[model samples]
Target: MPAADQNATPPGFGITLDTAAAEPRVVVTGELDLLTSPQLQEALAGLIADENSRRVVADLTGVTFFDSSALNVVLHAQRQAGERDVELAVVPSPAVSRVIELTGVAEHLSVADDPRP
Candidate 1:
């Protein structure tokens, strides 16, 4: 693994996939809505597909805004991680956590203080 780098910015969103650590970290910034959910989905899917992947941490601390579509993407990633036997944790910003708590998905996914390894 190398150092962390800016991976992509898809329209209204930006994703930084840090693969240098033991468990890859995907940090999402900007608005996570209908237009940006797929970017996150693809990034997470790519991380999960790696056989070397043991776990993946989604750091949503940079997210300024979040919506149900983004939450849906996280939930889907959680399920995929489970099937792959890969641990998945989420570090949510206040805005993101509020939505997660409201939707009761927080209990289903591991919420961590640190998203880094």
Candidate 2:
């Protein structure tokens, strides 16, 4: 997919889980903004509900935008993961990282900057 496709919407964002990783991982691509946050939460729920998967690594390599609504979902997921004693790691896109850092969400998200493309 081209970079142009990532900023555009329901068509862009996608989540895929890789259970084969040793730790269950979720691949997050495209925009996770106001319009797409719910989808992210839904996808996260599918993994968070499973008791067997403790470590959740979110790969935000292709994400280009971030919003407070998306922050809510990530915070919610982090809280749930905390309650379950599941380790949560977020590989945030630089854009997303900057937003989180500026908004004080950096503390809540166990985030890394500029991951693989």
Q: Which stretches of candidate 2 lie over 4 Å from their true place?
A: 1-9, 113-117
Q: Write the per-residue lDDT of candidate 2 for residues 1-117, one digit (tens) a residue.
A: 545553355767787878777777778888888778887787677677788978778777778888889889989998988888886788888877888888886777777543332
Tens-digit per-residue lDDT, 2-87, candidate 1: 76444444555678899988789899988898777888899999999899999899999989899999999999999999999998
What C-alpha lDDT values do all the predictions have?
A: 0.87, 0.77
Going through the candidates in the order shown, the clash numbers are 0, 0
Q: After aligning candidate 1 to the native by TM-score, how far in Å is the CA of 93 from where it should be?
A: 0.5
Off by over 4 Å in 1: 1-12
